[model samples]
Target: MSSTDTIVHILPPLTNQAQVDETYKSKNVTINTQEVTDRPVLRRDNTGLRNFLADSQDNQNVGYDGEVDTLRRLGRFYNWILTFSVVTRYAFYILPVATLLAIPLSIFATIHKESNIKGIKMMGLFVWLEIVWSSLWIAKLCSKTLPRAFRLCCGVISAGTRKHSLMIKALEVPLSIVFWVIACWASIPVIAAFNPETDVTVLGSNVHWIRSLQKGFLASVPVACVFLVEKVVIEFITVNYHRTQFSARIQESKRRMHLFELLYEASTILFAPYCPKFADDDYIINTSLLSTVGKEIQNVTDLQTGTPIRIFDNLGRLGTGVTSVFGNIVSEVTGGQRVDSKSPHAVVSWALERRPASEALARRVFNSLVSEGNDALYQKDIERVLGPDNHHEAEEIFHALDKDANGDVSLEEMTMIVIELGEGRRAMTKSLHDVDRAIKALDRILMCVVLVGAGLIYGTFFSDNFFKNMSLYTTSLMSFSFAFAGTVQEFTGSCIFLFVKHPYDVGDRVEINNVDLVVEHISLLYTVFRRVDSQRKVQIPNIVNNGNWIENISRSQAMSEHFALAISAATTFEEIENLTEELKEFVLADENRRDYKSDIDVEVANVGDMSKLELKINLGYKSNWSNEKLRVARRSKFMCALLATLRKVQINAPGGGDVAIGDASRPAYSVSVSDEEAKISRMKYLDEKESNKYVKDKGI
Candidate 1:
């Protein structure tokens, strides 16, 4: 068919072909129309759908070009603001130290009555001003968010775009100008007081103008430090302000992105064709549209019912009972939900998840409180377990977890409390463990400071009397006393060393040298253990513990047991090999077997006569199943199953055709440590003993 005829066939014939020709020409399509048609024709609605798609595409493109300028400007402004803010932070750290040093110097000058020096009165006045200023600034910080307080007190926005950023910088100029003016004017008074023309005198002494100016400059040092501090503080506040605003903006952008994606998905779902013409054809619809819709449905339900409902309005209450100002601010900023760290479920969780000694203690406390198979526990029951020092904290935990405020806490409530405690205990244990080092250093330094300060004050006030009264004998006695204190401190130092360096922590099953024990508790001076043999608590000094070989039994995730079986020498090698394979399969089939660990091994343990052939096998299982009683039970069960398998396979012991466990005639026996292993163990023990010489010698 001709191209003209094909076009006519595809599109319906029109009563006015000329109008169709004109429509094609308007759309820039070439068409050959010979003449007008008089036949009445039907028109299909194809153009309607095409026009809709075109308009939708145009709408999506709107405002796209303008967003480029906005993004570029925002990036440049953010980088500039953050860079300046960082430089200001370094100034904050230095200014406070300068102010501190200035205070004593100013006081010393006044006390010595230097020329043109003011009385202690002026020193006190300036110090008082600084104190009041610091206190007020701190009060403002505590009362409001950093950004809000910064804007109010510093007269700056602290964060925003070019115009807004300029406005903030402009607002800060007036205050800065005023501060500089006052600082400069403060020096004029002292300078004029000592000028000959002014004839100024203070405390009945004529002062040189140069001397007055020097004192004036010294006084202004503190004021200038305070000014620098304020400036740094403003920048610090600005940095924080911008960071928080950026975070909020990021969250907003994420939500907008999600919304845009959802819209695109919906459009695709509505516009997509029902079927594809080719296998590799692209679909107009989003592939994940159905999943997105389901997620949206779920999100709507969660928003309507979940914790987020309480977030916006009740967020402030999260910091309700927190004592630290920093703690409160952190809580407020982070939504404050986790402040109740000592609550029952949280504490219990901390114990279990971190597997600390606290877990055992917490469990015992719970069991005692819920005695007689009772469902609930009283607060008093917990207090008894916690003892005096921890009673109040334990009670607070109990009350927080009780939820309904009932005097009794239920088992379910206790479980939840334990779960919540997991995070808290881990954090607290690490903090408490590390705090020893900090406190030790701080105490020694502070003691030295106090002693030196006391000695200086005494010498300054009564040096003549001290020299007159103190003799050679007195000096000798002082030296002996210091030696005695040093000896005592050495012992204390040993305790601190053990606290930080001891290998075994509480709750670990340890073998000290060759003696087995469970660590009951750990203290600075001693480690208390529960003897495995007698179940008696034993307290050993830190020095003694440090002198022993320490081993952690429960630390390994998997445990292995070795068995050497005696097979009848009369049995053929084929029967022995078949039996080994069968046992291997049997052990591997056990539910408790560790998949990641190497499978059970079966091999000849020793070369022997045909009458006493031996097979050695190694079986490893999950460590939790290897506790003493359970381990024995598991071994017995496996042995019985193995003997039964041997009988099924017709493998015989020396005496008869039946398989018998623990019979010398049977095919297997338990294996002990080999000679090589024993030697290595002995050497390790010796090495440990040698390494522990410091602790042992100190104890001696």
Candidate 2:
């Protein structure tokens, strides 16, 4: 038998029983195959493999077409809106200026007409010309479409080939020339049309010149207005059309890609037995395949069926398992309570029930976009997938995907998403290499700019400012100018520096002069850090002149803290050893400390002559150790547990051992001491006191 025939033979046949049962249970309408047609049909239009594939293809084509159409429609709508908006805006601005100019111009025109006075007519003509010029200027200022119109014109003229700056410059030159020509042309006609002989002028000038100029100027108004309006409208329409076309193209691309993705997913699922396993047993199937299925279903269901499904495609098997566990816990916790019924979870579920498939597709698409070069997927593509109504939802998904809050997704982010989606480590090393290169290039460019600016200030402005300040009057002006320029330059430089050189960002724990803090604010001139222990804000200037070390403690792989314990002198070394062992076990058993390397060491720090033993317990914590409160609480609990164990074992000496809590709140036990022990204790006390004094002195 042929492979196709063998596959067909192995395939399961659909039966009406399941559908009938579901309909009966839900009390919904059921379509009976037998009642619908007389022939025994092999394929159903709404279900089965063949129908699914055909429907997918058809839907993809429709989606592409729809996207294009929508883009075109929106572009046209915006163009018209922009045109009318600009015209209205310009009209409002010009009306006031025109009114002011009209008073003076009318008075001059009337005087020039009656007396035939040359001076009066000239004055009136100039006033009228001024009014027209002022009106034009006001219109130019008022037109909201000017900037966008200019940009669109530049873009078109440059054929998208020139740099933005060059295109703007190129367009500005022609626009300025056109404006001047139109203004001159309008004035010339007004000057020529004035006829003082037939007109009356009360003042002593020839009314003919004034009337002639006014008439010419008035005639030019219509021409100028038409030109401006036409330009604005044309630019708006062109831009809108271009945008619409671009959107349509993007939509079409996405639709085709989505169809391909669905096909790939289905094929993967169908031929699971033929695919080879790569690395581990866990790596048998690519998680992207499963996610793709969920994503496709989500997209189709959202677009066609309007259902919402909370898909787990973005999560790895382990992540999915954990998520499922947590979800179950959350459900159980809020299941019966009144609060549960009104919770966001309940709302989400209800929303999901209303549109399961759409929600599922959104989840899947979000995960894919975030995990797979989300930057490559533009806002337009998402709009196409989710439809216009759910564009806001797509935006939320995008924000969630950008976990680092960097405004852009990096390979690390993508890997994290893939890991969550259950895709084992793929070849993502190249992406990291690219990111490193980009960072290095940015740093180099910033360093160059800073050096150049510093050089310029030192050579041209610094020395000159001092010399000019010798004269008080000149000094004041020079100082003001210098200060203003410096301020502007500094502000601009700082903004540029932030984009290029990010020393520290929010949520990063840093250390300055041994004082640990979390970065609270990062500005150009200064960096502010909130002390971890006290939450006090510390400000540090970014001394660009001198390179300073800024330690990022959060980036470290591990952080360690020492716990000192002193036991009674009567307590034997053997007892101390046993106690230390117990402490070690407790610290090691802590889930929080599991990630740390197993290199714990416990030793007698000092032995007191009287009956005291000083022991130091060093513990290391993973960098990812979260829950600061819980960590401290756990340390306290460990100490308490050790104390109880010690008491149970009768390890306490005849004289009670004094316990002192140190770093991480780990307890320290101390015993009574003689002269030598006293010297050690005094020295230790002095060292701590000096440290505190130094901190205070430094204003840290």
Candidate 3:
């Protein structure tokens, strides 16, 4: 073939040849058209050639233009939203401040007997003055855009190392509300104090504390309003923006975890050429270079399928993914490139080849240079976009990888060490198991110590004092023995109930006397549960067995039945069947109900006597599903799906099912416990049934 023909075949056609020519001309890079025809044009600069290839590849992709446009539009939209948020936030802040100042100004005007500035005029002037001051104060406090400030503050607070994020969020709301209220009320006293000639009676007869309190209240109001505004703006941004950011951060973390795994696997795969062996006594241990490859494979599995990693052995720590452990690995391998570390293939290969440590060292050197005066080649952008915690973790990993205790790590050292480590690889499962066993042993020892301490205190003081006053050593000994026995029994019984009864563990669905919850924590003394609907944690005493009926929904034999539906009363039995059929199909189709022994039952529960017919659906499912929220959610979804199906069918045949949808409401459902069940529950109580039955039955 001719050289020109070969060049034509290899070089892809460019749409913007004119633009390319112009760029080359501006850079003083020669591009001979006649010479290009004979051979493929190659840039003298490698970086330039790479950029050209990348740009050309991106241009060929159909989605590239659309993605760019979409990103631009989204950026503009976010900016506009941020601007509006800032304006509205400041406006709300100024309103409260203006109102506070107006009260004092009116009092001053009245005292001066100046009719021009007495009522509305004085109020308007003060309002305007406060508005300007408040705006300026807010602007000074949050110099940047409100959203940015909020993100910074919330991000700082949300770091796990700080106090609980939820508690901080909780405190923000009430603190804002309380301080604003106090500040507003304080204005009344400030006005009275400032204007001595002002009639306190004109304000209110109840305004007794004039000078001292009035000024304090007035001064506090504006200051409080500023703080309140800050809190509100921060919370709004946190809920709407920061939440999504945090979720993105979590996803990014998972992605990095997968990359680390891939790198480990790739490293292992490359190490296959070495075929290193270790000896264990008489047996020659042929450890596969692919032994640690499972972690990488699992990470890839999780990323590809979006399944949570099962790190914990059982459901005790359900949803606690392997990402937590693997996250450290990702941080180490990626070093300064965590954002890009999602590329598992690259990470794995790097790890296998022992090039990651060299890359990490280069990154650090580059960063250090940029920190100095090397601004031309290295910039601030070169520094890793690491979360505060991730940055700290990366530093630790770098130090560990340095090996020789030198400030810097070299590729040769890294490769040699990694190869040695890989050769002697052992499964981490045994170590993890040992750790868990140790923790359990510690807990048991702690519990025994607490019980012994309690017993000692009771015997030493209470027993001696009571018996001494009665003048009987024998009685004291007997009392002490009885007390110790009682304490031991109570403690042991609590532990047994927690372990044996297993009403609810850390992640079980339970109902304490009809109050539904998902167990968050299970301890010897108490169980902490999050109410399924409200997501509020409730502490249930282990001593609840003393009277309260503790129902383990996780272990129930039968599923609780409850459902609501509305249909036109004028509808015939045949028409109702169409609706009921849809409902039945929905319930039966649910994955939760797949293991159900019996089919679902849908009945015309009530004829409202009006125009509507109330229908009840009784769906069956395995009771040990252990998530009441999931149960409710599944039922709701089924109902919605059924309703949609019915609507589709009815669309084809007009008036076939003349059903008027009732006011979208959720009615209360009640479950009745039989007398036998109640009696059985009472018999299990610790205290006398007769004495505390009423309180116990009340579910207190």
Candidate 4:
């Protein structure tokens, strides 16, 4: 392909401080998601199947209880069934076929040998050789279905990985026959002598080979040590770190796979960033050196639903609620310490808080509150759990626990509240920041160990390893292998990027070269960020980020945003100050007090071209800019108020001027706005529109 035809992808540049003001002044941006619900529900004619068939299950026989019993029964005898199948397969399929195939090959061997072959010697070697050569072909009876299933699950991925050699494949059957004849003859004459059986004859001579000659394969001992050494080293990491991530990925998929599949169907490009795949421990352990069996699933259901566990009672006791914004709702978390109200670790601490002193009593109470699914609890449930006598307190608790202002207390909220009834506020003295740092440190150490191990193996076994003569070549090979490791790309940048000049960490809202992004994940090699504008994942290598300027909005002490506007030069400085005063009063209102600070800085920036004035304004938000929704909302609210204030002050924006010829000035501008009157008229118009002129819009 020519360079001119090559497609290059570029990240979208975000509207900057200057650009955003221009856009808003011209009223260019349409209504965005920030003003709407997180995700709007689009109504359409029901195209879905009825629940009776889609969720169909026979209550009497196919219930969870019965399904569990059935699985238990099958699991108990599964190993026995597998063992018997393998035995019967070799007895019924392999031996009979190998015997029949060996008949003609034995005849060819004898014709070449000019002597009759012996029993248990010629047949035994032929069987072993036949099994070794034809085993992969025999497995094709089952493997034939694998490619189809793989393609179904992998989507576009299979085409790139699938290999083809048409010339070799065309001669497959004929070449198999020719190779089998030569292999069968050689097996009886040469490799046959190495078989376990004694008194084996070769070339019409009785020859029993010595044991050392038979075990010639042991010469490759040094190369075989790598696998054994790897196993030994891996145990240390397992014992310390545990198999948490792999198991967590599988478990987490139970709740997320359906969503991922829907996203994939919606847009493959958007879904590629969240590719979900799983590997089975059983197959990976000992299946085959080259291939193993696993499933690419279309339909997957959780085997079991997890119930809250007990945390404290001696019967052996079991187990809040601040929510970190946009945390568990997705899978990214920010904020510094787990002790913080909304962090997942705080939820853990709440669960383990030794409440009511009895595990059985706690379970009984929870069961009483929610008899069916222990997910959400309503006001009635709160009354039932706490009793009718403490109804007032129960109401307060219910309201407090309803974090999202949804009517009921969700399971997450229930699990997260930390209770402290009798003491003055003493800060939780501990934080889980060190815990995260420790895990990262351990992961880095493991990465180094794996890299060095791979380099040593490549140098010693694969490359030409000479103690003295080819020492330089071997050393260079090892160096190349080590340097080629994925994490090596981060080596120079990581030290300074993380410790010395660190701009951001995971979950930070940042700006890199004017592109606003939220840090979703940080790895040794690259950082994954989601564009605040488009919500698409962007992977920037650490080495690349090291060369760019980064602004960490989340870490900054103060949070503010500024925008510029071009207003009609006819407006006096007194009118501008009056507009600024209107904004100040708007910020100070009780309803707006929660989200905004009183630090409103509105000023005339410049007298531009004698036709218009440049006005720049900066407003401080109450919270850090980490919450994208709130930041967008606050900016939107302020902008609307600013426009209203400008209208009230008769300050015309620069674009509506009319051409004047001597005394023939044609005034092309008219402005009239009253917030109270507009609200009343808008509500009335909406009611009339819904009653008569409503047009249902489907997203198409």
By lDDT, the best candidate is: 4
**Candidate 1 TM-score over all chains jointly:** 0.34
Q: Summarize candidate 2's per-residue lDDT along 1-700 as a digit string, tens digits.
A: 6322332333123233233234333643211100011123332222333233334544655221111112356765655555556566555556666777777667766764543344344544565467456645644443433556656767676766334443334344335434644565445434434554343432222455544544443444444444444444334433443344234544543443343243223333333311222111112221211233234432222334445322222222324334345556866876732323212232222222222322332333334433244444444554455568877755664454444333444433433433322111111222223333433444454555545544444333325564454477556767689657965565555444443344454555666677777766554455567887897888865554125466765445456667877666677767767766765666555342333334566777887775677777776654332235545765676567767868865576546744445735666668877999899989999999987774434564
Cα error of candidate 4 at position 612, Å: 1.5
Report the CA-based lDDT of candidate 3 relative to the real structure. Answer: 0.44
Alpha-carbon runs more than 4 Å astray in model 4: 1-467, 470-502, 655-700
* Model 3 lDDT per residue over 1-700, tens place: 6322332333233234233234444754321100001123232222332233335434655221211112356765655555566666566556677777777767746774443323223443454456445545444444333344455677776754232344344444435444444534434433334345555532342333443344444444444444455545434433443343234544544454443343333333333211222011001111111122234421222334454322211111111123233545767865633322223343332333333333442232233322344322211212232334465444544444444333444434344434433221211222223323433543565555545544444454335475455447566668789658866666666655644454544444667777887766555566677897688989877766635677776546556566676765556677667766665655554243333324667687876766577777676653344544445665676657766865754522322353354524634467889999988877877556566666535564
Better of 1 and 2 by lDDT: 1
Candidate structures ordered by TM-score, highest first: 4, 1, 2, 3
For model 3 the local lDDT of residue 373 reads 42
Most accurate candidate by TM-score: 4
Stretches of model 1 off by over 4 angstroms after superposition = 1-502, 532-534, 564-575, 590-598, 607-615, 624-636, 639-700
Against the true structure, candidate 4 reaches a TM-score of 0.35
- How many residue pairs collide in each prediction? 23, 57, 8, 12
The C-alpha lDDT values of all candidates are 0.47, 0.45, 0.44, 0.47
Q: Model 3 — TM-score against the truth?
A: 0.27
- Judge candidate 2 at residue 267 and give its lDDT: 30
Model 4 score (lDDT)? 0.47
Write the candidate numbers in order of decreasing lDDT. 4, 1, 2, 3
Model 2 poorest ten-residue lDDT run: 29-38
